[model samples]
Target chain A: MSAVGSLVAGSLAFMAPLAPAAIGGLATEYVGALNIALEGLILVGAFSYAAAGSIAGPIVGFAAALLSSAIVAAGADLFSRKAKADPFVVGLGVNMLAPAAASILSQAVFDTKGVAVVAGLQSAMALPGLRYSDVASFAVAAAIIAAIAATPFGTRSRAAGMSRDSLAMAGVDYGRVRGAAYFVSGLACGATGAALAASVGAWVPNMSAGRGWIALVAVYLGGKRLGGTVAAVAMFSLLLSAAAAAQAVVELPAELLLSIPYFTAALVVIVGARGSARRSARRRAP
Target chain B: MRPGFRTRFHIETIHDAGGTKAAVRLVAALASAATLAALAAAFLSSEPSSALRAFFLAPFGTEAAFLSTLELAAPLAVCALGVIVSFRAGHYSLGGEGQAYAGSFAAALAAPVLYEALGPASVPLSILIGASAGALVAAPSAIGKRLAGADVLLTSILVSQGVIFAVDWAIGGPFRDRSSNLVAMEALPRGALLPRLAPPSTLTAASIVALAACLAAAFYFDRTRSGAAHDLYGRNQRFAELQGFDVARLSWAPIIAAGVLHGAAGAMMALGARGTAIRGMSGGIGWSAIGAALVAGSRPQALPFAAVLFAWLDSGSRQASILSDLPPDAGQAIKAVVILAVSARPAIAALRRRR
Candidate 1:
């Protein structure tokens, strides 16, 4: 029972860090834009958190990450909306630019290709007697999921997603709503990056390692529902943790095991076309 | 109606259409010329006169350096040409990096065994083997798209990363060269080396083959019905479907063609490097190819010029580092600036026209 509980909690904790990106994916579709720059946004957020944590406290680091990501998200929005560039291409260019910039700065500062440990950030801890950090992260994720599901803003965002012109007819500024949602989503992602950095006590280039895509898969698997997204993320995260732990007992290369989550996500997306039906049903429901 | 009148009407219409086409062509040529001049002026104003001279001419200052630059640009041009095909068909193949690596892996594996068995005959066989390996690795994404309605952009990217990690693991375990500490496979046999075109300059017959391939691609695009169909599909998929074109088949052709070219590039790189497959042997050429494709606006003929420009920057950066205090990374920065400039040009022009 204890082992099961721990496993469930661990999965939830892992899913928590993924929520912001899942939310960003959901929000992008709503705003008539594809948030393909999520990977780059996450990288920038991670680097910002690390840099700020090394200079200031963990709280400041988190704030810095949020600010930087919001700036980047805003820039992405401006380029896509005002410039009339292809969103997919521009998003890819943004993705390429981030890693190159990060690598150049990282090389200049640390004289290394990857990132170094930030000094001032607080690592995730068990709070003296209990494993509070993991539990708290899970709880925070759950609360955010519930809030988005229940809130008027979330409904409005969903409405915008379904049909931007219809939302505009209802006197909602679709662009502003999208811009705001993307900003908030980026902040959440930044905080998640900060948490990951704090928990691990170091950063590496490509540290997220397609986790942003996993979040995207979770969104699709969950049919863009708050509860379903959480459930999907938790399920995959558990698989990831189990795969990691299995490295000890199995002679197979860990890389092969690490591929399981991605393969699983792809399989789910392919086989479970039912998610689209559920989404349509939700649209028709009260 | 008489047949003579109908034929006369048809000739007149053709003549008028041809005239309009010639006028449009003339305008486009002028626009391109003006843009090139503007770019040159911008460069001249920003740098010292001597620096400007070196920037454009340094790569050609010596026969050896000029040849080496072409050799480096050849594989990049091939990969970029592949990217052009994929992009022209409206598919985002971000998997070129992985595909290239896959080909390299196959070539590296085949090199030693074939060299030992067949001596000098192993070279061409190894190249063919490598190209096939890349195509095989890339085939699944297209299959996934057709079967599952999966997004090629996402699936191809994930598969690319998976292939890279898998290759890394294989190198670390089964193919690990125990004699070396650098985590690379064993070196290829001497007989497997590609024939050099010029001694000590890395120029090889592979570069000539790549150039011929580029020209063939250009001809195919300009003079084929299927090529026109591809253009139509890229411009408007629903319209193409309405016109009774098989969208799936059209999309698949360009993607597979891209994979083949990228695979060929990998084989060429392995052959040129004398069968050594280092991690990152493609040296971000896939990404550079994407950049080149974007700059060329998915035109096969435009790829060589864009690729040469990139190669110039790469070589000029090294030259600049030796002659001045600027770092080699400065070249990378300049390349980034060029990408930003080109991507922004259309938007800037559109805004101006609007005003």
Candidate 2:
């Protein structure tokens, strides 16, 4: 493959893990909350899918991932809606809890500390040299975008997120709508984790590795628009790909080089923050 | 108290997910979580009887096991103290993992050089340096939150991950001890290690420091004027500013203090027990500490016991794994459940108002 071709391939591969969560998070974002448990949800999904897939099959793995993630995602709503817990706190707690759960589960089931291997997970399909998982994530993103654009569920979710009082006045149960959105959001992130494990063909502890957070960053950089979010993910992936490609020639330490994407995230936040500030200042001046 | 102040205090107190309801919730949640864990073990373990014995009584089974549990709790308690400071100040810094890691690395790196010059006096100085490193790592996020309105949650975690990646690389690549088989650097000199409680038990003087830190943190938040001011600012920043408090200072101080305590904890793990910066040595302590802080409801008085409880759970699980056919992660599951339960407080009063 050409250098550019390889970069594109790398970008797609890296972007797959993030795309589902970003797109799904947009649903929650529309419903006036961000699914903070993206990391934990992803982790749970990856482990469930990997463990189940290895034992049964990939289909079973995927189903297990979806169900587990949805349950965790719904916990946010249950706590926030009925019990009135803060989403962020609940999310933080889940993030901490999920990995420990995964670690313990792996140790118990597989007797592994940080990794468990699954055979036959390697992609048997490829399109134009793109990894199958990458392509599948793209398809999932497209389907989600389509659902949001065409479905009543999408409209209600968006409405619930944007303005609760107005949504309530319109005779819709905004909380219920939001609770449903989080479930969907959970599935999307869960799938992302599963896809990530499938890409590696193993359930490695800490494998999600902040990809969920990156998905959130993509959502921010994309202006919360679907296309922009995908594009932002592509951009970040390009940086990662370029960093990977550079390692053969670059004299810098691998750790320093590995920090490229995070530095980009910090950079994106700074740039995004400043732009919003400028826009707000202009609005105030008027 | 007047109705107005009482209401405002209610608002602030509930934000940290601890209070009257929390105490009740803590017991209820803990009971259910523990029960669930026991049930899982009864079903899951190959040797249920041995697992039960290890899980419940092994930590107190012997002197070494008991002291080892305290040794583990010491760093965790300090880390929780770090977490409570920031959470109480209304700033969430999830960078405790990185802060602790950085502290360990910094102390490990600085100890030998300092030891050569200062003799035994270098131990405390190295630990101080280690703590400063953690505080430094946290500074950007703290400053960003104060000055730029950046999301401290994201920024702190981002900075922390970046540091961990860098440090992990450094320990593996640049600092790789050609002499050792394990992926770790040189061990601290005998003088550099924290004085042990006794032989065959790894408990050290660092446990006392951790205790002192919890007491001080509790006293600071509960007794001092600055602590009160900090709480007011955390509960309501605009209200604090309106009432003539220095909101900006309050905003950053908790984060810095948290960084220090977290760093100290990391330093403790290195200087007190490990004797060197082992690969991923500070792993999970940050997350465990956050859960521990929640269990304590950000109260210093309750922190030690909470830390010990977490240590007990962890050590017990390790014992179960060692003595019986039990999974090592079982303890982690229980800890997660407990943390979730502890942090599940909702602003019920606010909900009632809306309704």
Most accurate candidate by TM-score? 2
| Model 1 spans > 4 angstroms off | A1-13, A107-113, A127-152, A273-286, B1-61, B314-337, B345-355
lDDT of 1 by residue, A1-286 (tens): 3656756655655665676667666556544455667777778777777777777767677778778977887777766566555555556666666666666566555566576876656465664222332344344445445545678777777787668888989999987877777775666566566656666666677666767767766665665566666677778889876776668778889978877666666556545543444555799999
Q: Each model's RMSD to truth, in Å?
A: 8.8, 5.0
**TM-score of each candidate?**
0.82, 0.91
How high is the lDDT of residue A11 in model 2? Answer: 74
Which pairs of residues clash in candidate 1, taking residues 3 or more apart in a chain or in different chains? A30-A161
DockQ of each candidate's interface versus the true one?
0.16, 0.39
In DockQ, how does model 1 score against the reference complex? 0.16
Model 2, DockQ value? 0.39
- Quantify how close model 1 is to the true structure by its C-alpha RMSD in Å: 8.8
lDDT of 2 at B245: 86
Say which docking band candidate 2 falls in: acceptable
